[model samples]
Target: MGRTSDAGEKILAAGRSLFEARGYSALGVAEICKAAGVPKGSFYYFYASKEALALAVVDEHWADQRREWTRILSGVGKDGGDAGGAQPLDRLRKLFEETEAGQHAVQQGCGTVLGCLFGNLSLEMSNQTEAVRARLQEIFDAQVEMVAAVIGEARERGDVTVNDSREAARSVVAQLEGQVMFAKLYNNTGRLSPLWGNCLALLGARAA
Candidate 1:
Protein backbone atom coordinates (compact mmCIF):
# COMPACT_ATOMS: atom_id res chain seq x y z
CA MET A 1 0.00 0.00 0.00
CA GLY A 2 2.84 2.39 0.88
CA ARG A 3 4.61 1.60 -2.38
CA THR A 4 1.44 2.20 -4.33
CA SER A 5 0.95 5.55 -2.64
CA ASP A 6 4.56 6.47 -3.39
CA ALA A 7 4.05 5.59 -7.02
CA GLY A 8 1.00 7.83 -7.21
CA GLU A 9 2.95 10.66 -5.60
CA LYS A 10 5.74 10.17 -8.13
CA ILE A 11 3.23 10.50 -10.95
CA LEU A 12 1.75 13.66 -9.40
CA ALA A 13 5.19 15.23 -8.92
CA ALA A 14 6.15 14.49 -12.52
CA GLY A 15 2.87 15.88 -13.76
CA ARG A 16 3.37 19.07 -11.72
CA SER A 17 6.87 19.64 -13.09
CA LEU A 18 5.76 19.05 -16.64
CA PHE A 19 2.72 21.27 -16.23
CA GLU A 20 4.90 23.99 -14.74
CA ALA A 21 7.58 23.81 -17.42
CA ARG A 22 5.16 23.39 -20.26
CA GLY A 23 1.50 24.36 -20.10
CA TYR A 24 -1.37 21.85 -19.96
CA SER A 25 -1.85 21.31 -23.68
CA ALA A 26 1.79 20.41 -24.08
CA LEU A 27 1.77 17.68 -21.42
CA GLY A 28 -0.07 14.39 -21.83
CA VAL A 29 -0.67 11.39 -19.61
CA ALA A 30 1.72 9.20 -21.56
CA GLU A 31 4.52 11.69 -21.13
CA ILE A 32 3.82 12.02 -17.44
CA CYS A 33 3.79 8.25 -16.99
CA LYS A 34 7.05 8.02 -18.90
CA ALA A 35 8.65 10.67 -16.72
CA ALA A 36 7.39 8.94 -13.57
CA GLY A 37 8.68 5.60 -14.78
CA VAL A 38 5.19 4.20 -14.29
CA PRO A 39 3.49 2.04 -16.86
CA LYS A 40 0.41 3.23 -18.72
CA GLY A 41 -1.54 0.52 -16.92
CA SER A 42 -0.39 1.85 -13.57
CA PHE A 43 -1.35 5.37 -14.57
CA TYR A 44 -4.93 4.27 -15.23
CA TYR A 45 -4.97 2.53 -11.88
CA PHE A 46 -4.24 5.85 -10.16
CA TYR A 47 -5.93 8.56 -12.20
CA ALA A 48 -9.02 8.00 -14.35
CA SER A 49 -7.79 10.41 -17.04
CA LYS A 50 -5.42 13.25 -17.76
CA GLU A 51 -8.04 15.75 -16.67
CA ALA A 52 -8.49 13.94 -13.39
CA LEU A 53 -4.76 14.05 -12.86
CA ALA A 54 -4.78 17.74 -13.67
CA LEU A 55 -7.43 18.36 -11.04
CA ALA A 56 -5.41 16.44 -8.50
CA VAL A 57 -2.36 18.47 -9.39
CA VAL A 58 -4.27 21.70 -8.92
CA ASP A 59 -5.61 20.58 -5.56
CA GLU A 60 -2.19 19.56 -4.32
CA HIS A 61 -0.53 22.71 -5.57
CA TRP A 62 -3.04 25.03 -3.88
CA ALA A 63 -2.93 23.03 -0.67
CA ASP A 64 0.84 23.39 -0.60
CA GLN A 65 0.63 27.10 -1.33
CA ARG A 66 -1.87 27.68 1.48
CA ARG A 67 0.39 25.90 3.92
CA GLU A 68 3.38 27.95 2.78
CA TRP A 69 1.47 31.20 3.16
CA THR A 70 0.23 30.15 6.57
CA ARG A 71 3.75 29.38 7.70
CA ILE A 72 5.03 32.74 6.54
CA LEU A 73 2.21 34.68 8.13
CA SER A 74 2.29 32.69 11.35
CA GLY A 75 6.00 33.29 11.80
CA VAL A 76 5.66 37.05 11.83
CA GLY A 77 5.41 37.48 15.60
CA LYS A 78 5.81 33.99 16.93
CA ASP A 79 8.84 32.58 18.62
CA GLY A 80 11.83 32.36 16.28
CA GLY A 81 10.13 34.95 14.09
CA ASP A 82 11.66 36.08 10.84
CA ALA A 83 13.32 39.51 10.88
CA GLY A 84 12.77 40.49 14.48
CA GLY A 85 11.74 44.08 15.13
CA ALA A 86 10.27 44.43 11.67
CA GLN A 87 6.83 45.91 11.13
CA PRO A 88 4.01 43.91 9.53
CA LEU A 89 4.67 45.55 6.19
CA ASP A 90 8.35 44.74 6.53
CA ARG A 91 7.46 41.15 7.20
CA LEU A 92 5.30 41.16 4.10
CA ARG A 93 8.26 42.48 2.13
CA LYS A 94 10.36 39.67 3.54
CA LEU A 95 7.75 37.23 2.28
CA PHE A 96 8.13 38.54 -1.27
CA GLU A 97 11.89 38.66 -0.93
CA GLU A 98 11.91 35.02 0.09
CA THR A 99 9.69 34.17 -2.85
CA GLU A 100 12.03 36.02 -5.22
CA ALA A 101 15.03 34.20 -3.77
CA GLY A 102 13.33 30.88 -4.35
CA GLN A 103 12.62 31.85 -7.94
CA HIS A 104 16.25 32.75 -8.55
CA ALA A 105 17.36 29.54 -6.83
CA VAL A 106 15.34 27.53 -9.35
CA GLN A 107 16.88 29.62 -12.15
CA GLN A 108 13.38 30.34 -13.43
CA GLY A 109 11.91 33.61 -12.32
CA CYS A 110 8.41 33.66 -10.74
CA GLY A 111 7.96 29.88 -10.23
CA THR A 112 5.77 29.08 -13.18
CA VAL A 113 3.27 26.64 -11.64
CA LEU A 114 0.55 29.12 -10.63
CA GLY A 115 1.02 31.30 -13.69
CA CYS A 116 1.25 28.43 -16.16
CA LEU A 117 -1.69 26.50 -14.81
CA PHE A 118 -4.08 29.43 -14.36
CA GLY A 119 -3.04 31.41 -17.42
CA ASN A 120 -3.14 28.44 -19.73
CA LEU A 121 -6.39 27.07 -18.40
CA SER A 122 -8.13 30.44 -18.30
CA LEU A 123 -7.39 30.86 -21.98
CA GLU A 124 -7.85 27.29 -23.13
CA MET A 125 -10.40 25.71 -20.80
CA SER A 126 -12.82 28.55 -20.15
CA ASN A 127 -15.53 26.96 -22.27
CA GLN A 128 -14.52 23.34 -21.90
CA THR A 129 -13.44 22.80 -18.30
CA GLU A 130 -15.68 24.69 -15.96
CA ALA A 131 -14.81 22.52 -12.98
CA VAL A 132 -11.12 23.11 -13.35
CA ARG A 133 -11.66 26.79 -13.88
CA ALA A 134 -13.89 27.03 -10.81
CA ARG A 135 -11.34 25.23 -8.66
CA LEU A 136 -8.62 27.57 -9.81
CA GLN A 137 -10.87 30.52 -9.17
CA GLU A 138 -11.53 29.34 -5.62
CA ILE A 139 -7.82 29.12 -4.94
CA PHE A 140 -7.32 32.62 -6.30
CA ASP A 141 -10.24 33.94 -4.28
CA ALA A 142 -8.80 32.52 -1.08
CA GLN A 143 -5.49 34.19 -1.81
CA VAL A 144 -7.22 37.50 -2.39
CA GLU A 145 -9.03 37.18 0.91
CA MET A 146 -5.74 36.55 2.65
CA VAL A 147 -4.30 39.68 1.10
CA ALA A 148 -7.37 41.59 2.20
CA ALA A 149 -6.81 40.51 5.77
CA VAL A 150 -3.25 41.77 5.67
CA ILE A 151 -4.34 45.06 4.18
CA GLY A 152 -7.18 45.33 6.65
CA GLU A 153 -4.68 45.09 9.48
CA ALA A 154 -2.63 47.82 7.91
CA ARG A 155 -5.68 50.00 7.59
CA GLU A 156 -6.61 49.49 11.21
CA ARG A 157 -3.19 50.69 12.23
CA GLY A 158 -3.43 53.70 9.92
CA ASP A 159 -0.52 52.38 7.91
CA VAL A 160 -2.41 52.51 4.65
CA THR A 161 -4.70 55.01 2.99
CA VAL A 162 -7.04 52.47 1.45
CA ASN A 163 -10.62 53.12 2.54
CA ASP A 164 -11.90 49.71 1.62
CA SER A 165 -9.91 46.64 2.61
CA ARG A 166 -11.82 44.46 0.19
CA GLU A 167 -11.08 46.69 -2.77
CA ALA A 168 -7.48 47.19 -1.76
CA ALA A 169 -7.09 43.46 -1.39
CA ARG A 170 -8.51 42.85 -4.83
CA SER A 171 -6.23 45.46 -6.34
CA VAL A 172 -3.14 44.00 -4.72
CA VAL A 173 -4.13 40.51 -5.77
CA ALA A 174 -4.68 41.68 -9.32
CA GLN A 175 -1.29 43.36 -9.30
CA LEU A 176 0.36 40.17 -8.08
CA GLU A 177 -1.23 38.09 -10.82
CA GLY A 178 -0.36 40.76 -13.38
CA GLN A 179 3.22 40.82 -12.20
CA VAL A 180 3.46 37.07 -12.58
CA MET A 181 1.99 37.27 -16.07
CA PHE A 182 4.47 39.97 -17.03
CA ALA A 183 7.33 37.92 -15.62
CA LYS A 184 6.24 34.90 -17.61
CA LEU A 185 5.93 36.95 -20.80
CA TYR A 186 9.31 38.59 -20.40
CA ASN A 187 11.02 35.46 -19.03
CA ASN A 188 12.49 37.68 -16.33
CA THR A 189 11.46 38.15 -12.69
CA GLY A 190 13.08 41.56 -12.51
CA ARG A 191 9.93 43.02 -14.01
CA LEU A 192 8.37 42.53 -10.58
CA SER A 193 11.06 44.53 -8.72
CA PRO A 194 9.56 47.94 -9.33
CA LEU A 195 6.06 46.71 -8.69
CA TRP A 196 7.03 45.67 -5.18
CA GLY A 197 7.47 49.30 -4.22
CA ASN A 198 4.30 50.20 -6.00
CA CYS A 199 2.45 47.68 -3.82
CA LEU A 200 3.88 49.30 -0.72
CA ALA A 201 2.85 52.70 -1.97
CA LEU A 202 -0.65 51.43 -2.61
CA LEU A 203 -0.75 50.37 1.01
CA GLY A 204 0.33 53.91 2.01
CA ALA A 205 3.67 52.67 3.22
CA ARG A 206 6.81 54.61 2.41
CA ALA A 207 9.14 52.81 0.02
CA ALA A 208 11.96 51.05 1.74
Candidate 2:
Protein backbone atom coordinates (compact mmCIF):
# COMPACT_ATOMS: atom_id res chain seq x y z
CA MET A 1 0.00 0.00 0.00
CA GLY A 2 1.14 3.49 -0.87
CA ARG A 3 1.02 6.57 1.33
CA THR A 4 -2.34 7.54 -0.10
CA SER A 5 -3.74 4.09 0.61
CA ASP A 6 -2.37 4.17 4.12
CA ALA A 7 -3.96 7.54 4.77
CA GLY A 8 -7.26 6.32 3.40
CA GLU A 9 -7.15 3.27 5.70
CA LYS A 10 -6.44 5.46 8.73
CA ILE A 11 -9.40 7.62 7.86
CA LEU A 12 -11.54 4.51 7.43
CA ALA A 13 -10.39 3.01 10.71
CA ALA A 14 -11.29 6.15 12.62
CA GLY A 15 -14.60 6.44 10.82
CA ARG A 16 -15.47 2.81 11.57
CA SER A 17 -14.84 3.20 15.30
CA LEU A 18 -16.82 6.41 15.54
CA PHE A 19 -19.64 5.03 13.47
CA GLU A 20 -19.81 1.90 15.58
CA ALA A 21 -19.46 3.69 18.91
CA ARG A 22 -21.71 6.63 18.12
CA GLY A 23 -23.29 6.57 14.68
CA TYR A 24 -23.14 8.07 11.20
CA SER A 25 -25.42 11.01 11.99
CA ALA A 26 -23.84 11.81 15.35
CA LEU A 27 -20.27 11.88 14.05
CA GLY A 28 -19.16 14.54 11.62
CA VAL A 29 -16.48 14.72 8.96
CA ALA A 30 -14.36 17.02 11.09
CA GLU A 31 -14.64 14.58 13.96
CA ILE A 32 -13.49 11.73 11.77
CA CYS A 33 -10.66 13.83 10.37
CA LYS A 34 -9.56 14.80 13.85
CA ALA A 35 -9.74 11.21 14.97
CA ALA A 36 -7.65 10.15 12.02
CA GLY A 37 -5.12 12.84 12.77
CA VAL A 38 -5.45 14.07 9.19
CA PRO A 39 -6.21 17.51 7.87
CA LYS A 40 -9.79 18.18 6.82
CA GLY A 41 -8.57 18.75 3.29
CA SER A 42 -7.28 15.19 3.11
CA PHE A 43 -10.70 13.77 3.83
CA TYR A 44 -12.01 14.96 0.51
CA TYR A 45 -8.90 13.61 -1.18
CA PHE A 46 -10.06 10.11 -0.15
CA TYR A 47 -13.82 10.52 -0.04
CA ALA A 48 -16.23 12.86 -1.75
CA SER A 49 -18.23 13.60 1.41
CA LYS A 50 -19.16 12.24 4.77
CA GLU A 51 -21.75 10.01 3.14
CA ALA A 52 -19.09 8.58 0.86
CA LEU A 53 -16.80 7.94 3.76
CA ALA A 54 -19.67 6.30 5.62
CA LEU A 55 -20.30 3.94 2.75
CA ALA A 56 -16.64 2.97 2.82
CA VAL A 57 -16.76 2.44 6.55
CA VAL A 58 -19.85 0.29 6.23
CA ASP A 59 -18.24 -1.80 3.53
CA GLU A 60 -15.06 -2.24 5.54
CA HIS A 61 -16.97 -3.18 8.64
CA TRP A 62 -19.09 -5.65 6.71
CA ALA A 63 -16.04 -7.28 5.21
CA ASP A 64 -14.44 -7.70 8.62
CA GLN A 65 -17.62 -9.19 10.07
CA ARG A 66 -18.04 -11.59 7.17
CA ARG A 67 -14.54 -12.82 7.85
CA GLU A 68 -15.30 -13.26 11.53
CA TRP A 69 -18.48 -15.21 10.82
CA THR A 70 -16.62 -17.32 8.32
CA ARG A 71 -14.03 -18.16 10.94
CA ILE A 72 -16.64 -19.29 13.45
CA LEU A 73 -18.56 -21.24 10.86
CA SER A 74 -15.40 -22.86 9.61
CA GLY A 75 -14.11 -23.71 13.07
CA VAL A 76 -16.91 -26.16 14.02
CA GLY A 77 -15.55 -29.21 12.21
CA LYS A 78 -12.50 -31.40 12.47
CA ASP A 79 -12.02 -31.04 8.72
CA GLY A 80 -12.77 -27.35 9.17
CA GLY A 81 -16.04 -27.45 7.33
CA ASP A 82 -19.00 -25.24 8.15
CA ALA A 83 -19.07 -25.57 11.92
CA GLY A 84 -17.52 -28.97 11.43
CA GLY A 85 -20.85 -30.44 10.45
CA ALA A 86 -21.88 -30.09 14.07
CA GLN A 87 -25.62 -30.03 13.42
CA PRO A 88 -26.19 -26.80 11.55
CA LEU A 89 -28.51 -25.63 14.29
CA ASP A 90 -25.84 -26.17 16.93
CA ARG A 91 -23.32 -24.48 14.72
CA LEU A 92 -25.61 -21.52 14.43
CA ARG A 93 -25.97 -21.45 18.21
CA LYS A 94 -22.22 -21.61 18.56
CA LEU A 95 -21.95 -18.75 16.12
CA PHE A 96 -24.13 -16.63 18.39
CA GLU A 97 -22.11 -17.76 21.39
CA GLU A 98 -18.96 -16.61 19.66
CA THR A 99 -20.62 -13.32 18.83
CA GLU A 100 -21.69 -12.85 22.44
CA ALA A 101 -18.24 -13.83 23.63
CA GLY A 102 -16.76 -11.18 21.39
CA GLN A 103 -19.02 -8.54 22.89
CA HIS A 104 -18.20 -9.69 26.41
CA ALA A 105 -14.49 -9.62 25.64
CA VAL A 106 -14.77 -5.96 24.74
CA GLN A 107 -17.02 -5.39 27.78
CA GLN A 108 -19.41 -3.79 25.32
CA GLY A 109 -22.76 -5.05 24.23
CA CYS A 110 -23.30 -5.91 20.57
CA GLY A 111 -19.98 -5.33 18.83
CA THR A 112 -21.60 -5.60 15.43
CA VAL A 113 -22.05 -2.41 13.41
CA LEU A 114 -24.81 -3.47 11.03
CA GLY A 115 -27.76 -3.57 13.42
CA CYS A 116 -26.88 -0.38 15.29
CA LEU A 117 -25.85 1.60 12.25
CA PHE A 118 -28.92 0.58 10.32
CA GLY A 119 -31.24 1.29 13.19
CA ASN A 120 -29.72 4.71 13.73
CA LEU A 121 -29.48 5.75 10.07
CA SER A 122 -32.87 4.34 9.14
CA LEU A 123 -34.47 6.67 11.64
CA GLU A 124 -32.37 9.67 10.63
CA MET A 125 -31.64 9.40 6.89
CA SER A 126 -34.22 7.09 5.39
CA ASN A 127 -36.18 10.00 3.98
CA GLN A 128 -33.18 12.06 2.97
CA THR A 129 -30.25 9.89 1.93
CA GLU A 130 -31.46 7.27 -0.47
CA ALA A 131 -27.91 6.23 -1.24
CA VAL A 132 -27.05 5.51 2.36
CA ARG A 133 -30.29 3.71 2.96
CA ALA A 134 -29.84 1.63 -0.15
CA ARG A 135 -26.30 0.67 0.79
CA LEU A 136 -27.38 -0.32 4.27
CA GLN A 137 -30.22 -2.39 2.90
CA GLU A 138 -27.86 -4.14 0.54
CA ILE A 139 -25.53 -5.11 3.35
CA PHE A 140 -28.45 -6.33 5.45
CA ASP A 141 -29.89 -8.30 2.62
CA ALA A 142 -26.58 -10.03 2.08
CA GLN A 143 -26.36 -10.91 5.74
CA VAL A 144 -29.81 -12.42 5.66
CA GLU A 145 -28.85 -14.36 2.60
CA MET A 146 -25.82 -15.77 4.39
CA VAL A 147 -28.02 -16.89 7.24
CA ALA A 148 -30.39 -18.49 4.81
CA ALA A 149 -27.52 -20.38 3.26
CA VAL A 150 -26.53 -21.83 6.59
CA ILE A 151 -30.07 -22.85 7.37
CA GLY A 152 -30.45 -24.37 3.96
CA GLU A 153 -27.30 -26.35 4.53
CA ALA A 154 -28.58 -27.51 7.87
CA ARG A 155 -31.78 -28.75 6.30
CA GLU A 156 -29.90 -30.60 3.62
CA ARG A 157 -27.75 -32.30 6.21
CA GLY A 158 -30.79 -33.35 8.24
CA ASP A 159 -29.69 -31.07 11.05
CA VAL A 160 -32.78 -28.96 10.51
CA THR A 161 -36.21 -29.54 9.01
CA VAL A 162 -37.14 -26.23 7.60
CA ASN A 163 -39.91 -26.10 5.01
CA ASP A 164 -38.49 -22.75 3.98
CA SER A 165 -34.86 -22.39 4.76
CA ARG A 166 -34.70 -18.89 3.39
CA GLU A 167 -37.57 -17.72 5.56
CA ALA A 168 -36.12 -19.46 8.57
CA ALA A 169 -32.77 -17.80 7.96
CA ARG A 170 -34.43 -14.40 7.63
CA SER A 171 -36.26 -14.97 10.89
CA VAL A 172 -33.04 -15.91 12.65
CA VAL A 173 -31.36 -12.81 11.33
CA ALA A 174 -34.30 -10.64 12.36
CA GLN A 175 -34.36 -12.13 15.84
CA LEU A 176 -30.64 -11.61 16.27
CA GLU A 177 -30.87 -8.03 15.05
CA GLY A 178 -33.78 -7.30 17.34
CA GLN A 179 -31.93 -8.80 20.28
CA VAL A 180 -28.91 -6.69 19.56
CA MET A 181 -31.06 -3.58 19.40
CA PHE A 182 -32.70 -4.40 22.70
CA ALA A 183 -29.38 -5.18 24.32
CA LYS A 184 -27.93 -1.87 23.23
CA LEU A 185 -30.98 0.11 24.24
CA TYR A 186 -30.98 -1.28 27.78
CA ASN A 187 -27.23 -1.78 28.12
CA ASN A 188 -27.93 -5.34 29.22
CA THR A 189 -25.72 -7.66 27.24
CA GLY A 190 -27.05 -10.67 29.13
CA ARG A 191 -30.36 -10.15 27.43
CA LEU A 192 -28.95 -11.80 24.32
CA SER A 193 -28.22 -15.15 25.93
CA PRO A 194 -31.84 -16.26 26.18
CA LEU A 195 -32.50 -15.11 22.67
CA TRP A 196 -29.63 -17.22 21.52
CA GLY A 197 -30.93 -20.22 23.38
CA ASN A 198 -34.40 -19.74 22.00
CA CYS A 199 -33.10 -19.53 18.46
CA LEU A 200 -31.15 -22.71 18.97
CA ALA A 201 -34.20 -24.46 20.29
CA LEU A 202 -36.24 -23.34 17.32
CA LEU A 203 -33.60 -24.63 14.97
CA GLY A 204 -33.34 -27.91 16.85
CA ALA A 205 -37.08 -28.47 16.86
CA ARG A 206 -37.30 -27.66 13.21
CA ALA A 207 -34.46 -30.06 12.52
CA ALA A 208 -36.19 -32.81 14.51
Candidate 3:
Protein backbone atom coordinates (compact mmCIF):
# COMPACT_ATOMS: atom_id res chain seq x y z
CA MET A 1 0.00 0.00 0.00
CA GLY A 2 2.83 2.39 0.85
CA ARG A 3 4.55 1.67 -2.44
CA THR A 4 1.28 2.07 -4.24
CA SER A 5 0.83 5.51 -2.74
CA ASP A 6 4.39 6.47 -3.64
CA ALA A 7 3.76 5.45 -7.23
CA GLY A 8 0.97 8.00 -7.47
CA GLU A 9 3.32 10.82 -6.41
CA LYS A 10 6.00 9.58 -8.77
CA ILE A 11 3.50 9.62 -11.61
CA LEU A 12 2.54 13.19 -10.77
CA ALA A 13 6.17 14.32 -10.69
CA ALA A 14 6.98 12.63 -13.95
CA GLY A 15 3.78 13.89 -15.57
CA ARG A 16 4.54 17.46 -14.54
CA SER A 17 8.11 17.29 -15.80
CA LEU A 18 7.13 15.79 -19.11
CA PHE A 19 4.18 18.14 -19.52
CA GLU A 20 6.41 21.13 -18.91
CA ALA A 21 9.13 19.88 -21.23
CA ARG A 22 7.03 18.58 -24.12
CA GLY A 23 3.55 20.05 -23.60
CA TYR A 24 0.45 18.00 -22.87
CA SER A 25 -0.62 16.82 -26.31
CA ALA A 26 2.67 15.21 -27.17
CA LEU A 27 2.96 12.75 -24.30
CA GLY A 28 1.27 9.40 -23.71
CA VAL A 29 0.50 7.51 -20.58
CA ALA A 30 2.97 4.78 -21.40
CA GLU A 31 5.74 7.31 -21.70
CA ILE A 32 4.74 8.92 -18.41
CA CYS A 33 4.68 5.56 -16.70
CA LYS A 34 8.11 4.70 -18.06
CA ALA A 35 9.58 7.96 -16.85
CA ALA A 36 7.93 7.51 -13.48
CA GLY A 37 9.31 3.97 -13.10
CA VAL A 38 5.84 2.79 -12.30
CA PRO A 39 3.59 0.28 -13.93
CA LYS A 40 1.03 1.56 -16.39
CA GLY A 41 -1.60 0.09 -14.11
CA SER A 42 -0.47 2.41 -11.38
CA PHE A 43 -1.47 5.37 -13.48
CA TYR A 44 -5.03 4.13 -13.96
CA TYR A 45 -5.14 3.40 -10.27
CA PHE A 46 -4.42 7.02 -9.48
CA TYR A 47 -5.87 8.94 -12.44
CA ALA A 48 -8.99 8.36 -14.50
CA SER A 49 -7.19 9.40 -17.67
CA LYS A 50 -4.44 11.54 -19.02
CA GLU A 51 -6.71 14.56 -18.82
CA ALA A 52 -7.35 13.88 -15.19
CA LEU A 53 -3.64 13.68 -14.57
CA ALA A 54 -3.14 16.89 -16.48
CA LEU A 55 -5.69 18.64 -14.32
CA ALA A 56 -4.00 17.32 -11.23
CA VAL A 57 -0.62 18.46 -12.53
CA VAL A 58 -1.97 21.91 -13.29
CA ASP A 59 -3.46 22.24 -9.83
CA GLU A 60 -0.26 21.06 -8.17
CA HIS A 61 1.90 23.43 -10.17
CA TRP A 62 -0.40 26.38 -9.49
CA ALA A 63 -0.45 25.60 -5.80
CA ASP A 64 3.32 25.84 -5.64
CA GLN A 65 3.49 28.96 -7.82
CA ARG A 66 0.66 30.68 -5.95
CA ARG A 67 2.46 30.12 -2.67
CA GLU A 68 5.65 31.67 -3.98
CA TRP A 69 3.74 34.57 -5.50
CA THR A 70 1.88 35.15 -2.27
CA ARG A 71 5.11 35.22 -0.33
CA ILE A 72 6.90 37.60 -2.71
CA LEU A 73 3.95 39.90 -3.43
CA SER A 74 3.10 40.10 0.26
CA GLY A 75 6.60 41.31 1.20
CA VAL A 76 7.11 38.54 3.68
CA GLY A 77 10.62 37.29 4.34
CA LYS A 78 11.69 33.74 3.63
CA ASP A 79 11.99 33.26 7.38
CA GLY A 80 8.43 34.41 8.03
CA GLY A 81 9.32 37.93 9.13
CA ASP A 82 8.75 41.29 7.47
CA ALA A 83 10.87 41.84 4.39
CA GLY A 84 12.20 45.13 5.74
CA GLY A 85 8.91 46.88 5.03
CA ALA A 86 9.19 46.69 1.28
CA GLN A 87 6.74 48.96 -0.47
CA PRO A 88 4.14 47.55 -2.87
CA LEU A 89 6.02 48.61 -5.97
CA ASP A 90 9.21 47.17 -4.56
CA ARG A 91 7.49 43.88 -3.89
CA LEU A 92 6.18 43.84 -7.45
CA ARG A 93 9.69 44.39 -8.79
CA LYS A 94 10.97 41.58 -6.62
CA LEU A 95 8.35 39.28 -8.15
CA PHE A 96 9.72 39.96 -11.60
CA GLU A 97 13.28 39.47 -10.44
CA GLU A 98 12.41 36.20 -8.82
CA THR A 99 10.65 35.04 -11.99
CA GLU A 100 13.67 35.91 -14.10
CA ALA A 101 15.98 34.15 -11.68
CA GLY A 102 13.81 31.05 -11.73
CA GLN A 103 13.82 30.90 -15.53
CA HIS A 104 17.56 31.43 -15.57
CA ALA A 105 18.09 28.60 -13.13
CA VAL A 106 15.96 26.28 -15.25
CA GLN A 107 17.94 27.27 -18.33
CA GLN A 108 21.17 26.57 -16.52
CA GLY A 109 20.00 23.09 -15.63
CA CYS A 110 18.19 22.14 -18.84
CA GLY A 111 19.87 24.29 -21.51
CA THR A 112 16.39 25.40 -22.61
CA VAL A 113 13.99 28.00 -21.32
CA LEU A 114 10.73 26.31 -20.35
CA GLY A 115 8.37 29.21 -20.08
CA CYS A 116 5.37 29.50 -17.79
CA LEU A 117 3.65 26.13 -17.64
CA PHE A 118 0.21 27.65 -17.40
CA GLY A 119 0.80 29.86 -20.41
CA ASN A 120 2.22 27.01 -22.40
CA LEU A 121 -0.64 24.70 -21.54
CA SER A 122 -3.15 27.39 -22.26
CA LEU A 123 -1.83 27.84 -25.74
CA GLU A 124 -1.73 24.13 -26.42
CA MET A 125 -4.72 22.74 -24.57
CA SER A 126 -7.17 25.51 -23.86
CA ASN A 127 -8.90 24.96 -27.17
CA GLN A 128 -8.90 21.21 -26.94
CA THR A 129 -10.28 20.56 -23.46
CA GLU A 130 -13.00 22.48 -21.68
CA ALA A 131 -11.84 21.21 -18.31
CA VAL A 132 -8.34 22.53 -18.84
CA ARG A 133 -9.61 25.71 -20.42
CA ALA A 134 -11.87 26.52 -17.48
CA ARG A 135 -9.16 25.61 -15.00
CA LEU A 136 -6.62 27.81 -16.74
CA GLN A 137 -9.07 30.67 -16.81
CA GLU A 138 -9.64 30.33 -13.09
CA ILE A 139 -5.91 30.24 -12.41
CA PHE A 140 -5.29 33.35 -14.48
CA ASP A 141 -8.22 35.15 -12.89
CA ALA A 142 -6.80 34.37 -9.46
CA GLN A 143 -3.41 35.65 -10.56
CA VAL A 144 -4.92 38.90 -11.77
CA GLU A 145 -6.78 39.29 -8.52
CA MET A 146 -3.60 38.82 -6.54
CA VAL A 147 -1.79 41.45 -8.58
CA ALA A 148 -4.78 43.75 -8.36
CA ALA A 149 -4.65 43.53 -4.59
CA VAL A 150 -1.05 44.67 -4.64
CA ILE A 151 -1.87 47.43 -7.10
CA GLY A 152 -4.65 48.56 -4.81
CA GLU A 153 -2.15 48.83 -1.99
CA ALA A 154 0.16 50.88 -4.21
CA ARG A 155 -2.73 53.16 -5.18
CA GLU A 156 -3.62 53.67 -1.56
CA ARG A 157 -0.05 54.72 -0.80
CA GLY A 158 0.00 57.15 -3.74
CA ASP A 159 2.66 55.10 -5.44
CA VAL A 160 0.66 54.56 -8.63
CA THR A 161 -1.94 56.54 -10.57
CA VAL A 162 -4.09 53.68 -11.80
CA ASN A 163 -7.87 54.12 -11.44
CA ASP A 164 -8.89 50.52 -12.01
CA SER A 165 -6.49 48.21 -10.26
CA ARG A 166 -8.03 45.00 -11.58
CA GLU A 167 -7.87 46.09 -15.20
CA ALA A 168 -4.31 47.27 -14.75
CA ALA A 169 -3.47 43.99 -13.12
CA ARG A 170 -4.88 42.10 -16.11
CA SER A 171 -2.59 44.06 -18.39
CA VAL A 172 0.34 43.34 -16.12
CA VAL A 173 -0.39 39.63 -16.23
CA ALA A 174 -0.76 39.71 -20.00
CA GLN A 175 2.52 41.56 -20.33
CA LEU A 176 4.24 39.03 -18.11
CA GLU A 177 2.98 36.06 -20.12
CA GLY A 178 3.84 37.72 -23.41
CA GLN A 179 7.37 38.47 -22.26
CA VAL A 180 7.82 34.94 -21.03
CA MET A 181 6.69 33.67 -24.44
CA PHE A 182 9.32 35.88 -26.04
CA ALA A 183 11.94 34.63 -23.60
CA LYS A 184 11.15 31.06 -24.53
CA LEU A 185 11.17 31.90 -28.24
CA TYR A 186 14.57 33.56 -28.00
CA ASN A 187 15.93 31.05 -25.53
CA ASN A 188 16.98 33.97 -23.35
CA THR A 189 15.73 34.70 -19.89
CA GLY A 190 16.99 38.27 -20.32
CA ARG A 191 13.75 39.00 -22.13
CA LEU A 192 12.14 39.16 -18.70
CA SER A 193 14.22 42.15 -17.64
CA PRO A 194 11.78 44.71 -19.04
CA LEU A 195 8.84 43.43 -17.03
CA TRP A 196 9.34 45.84 -14.15
CA GLY A 197 9.66 48.88 -16.40
CA ASN A 198 6.64 47.86 -18.41
CA CYS A 199 4.65 47.27 -15.25
CA LEU A 200 5.58 50.70 -13.90
CA ALA A 201 4.52 52.31 -17.15
CA LEU A 202 1.26 50.45 -17.10
CA LEU A 203 0.56 51.59 -13.57
CA GLY A 204 1.77 55.16 -14.13
CA ALA A 205 3.81 54.71 -11.02
CA ARG A 206 5.16 57.84 -9.31
CA ALA A 207 8.86 58.52 -9.48
CA ALA A 208 10.82 57.10 -6.59
Better of 1 and 2 by lDDT: 2
Across 137-188, the per-residue lDDT of candidate 1 in tens digits comes to: 8887887777777777777777778788778777766776677677667767
In candidate 3, the residue pairs with backbone N, CA or C atoms under 3 Å apart (3 or more residues apart, or in different chains) clash, namely none
Model 2: lDDT equals 0.72
Candidate 3's C-alpha runs over 4 A off are 1-5
Model 2 clashes, total count: 5
TM-score of each: 0.84, 0.82, 0.95
The better-scoring model by TM-score among 1 and 3 is 3
**Displacement of the residue 40 alpha carbon in candidate 3, Å:** 1.2
Ranking by TM-score: 3, 1, 2
Tell me the alpha-carbon RMSD of every candidate: 3.5, 3.8, 2.3
**lDDT-sorted candidate list, best first:** 3, 2, 1
| lDDT scores in order | 0.70, 0.72, 0.94
Candidate 2: which stretches are off by over 4 Å?
A: 1-5, 76-85, 108-115, 201-208
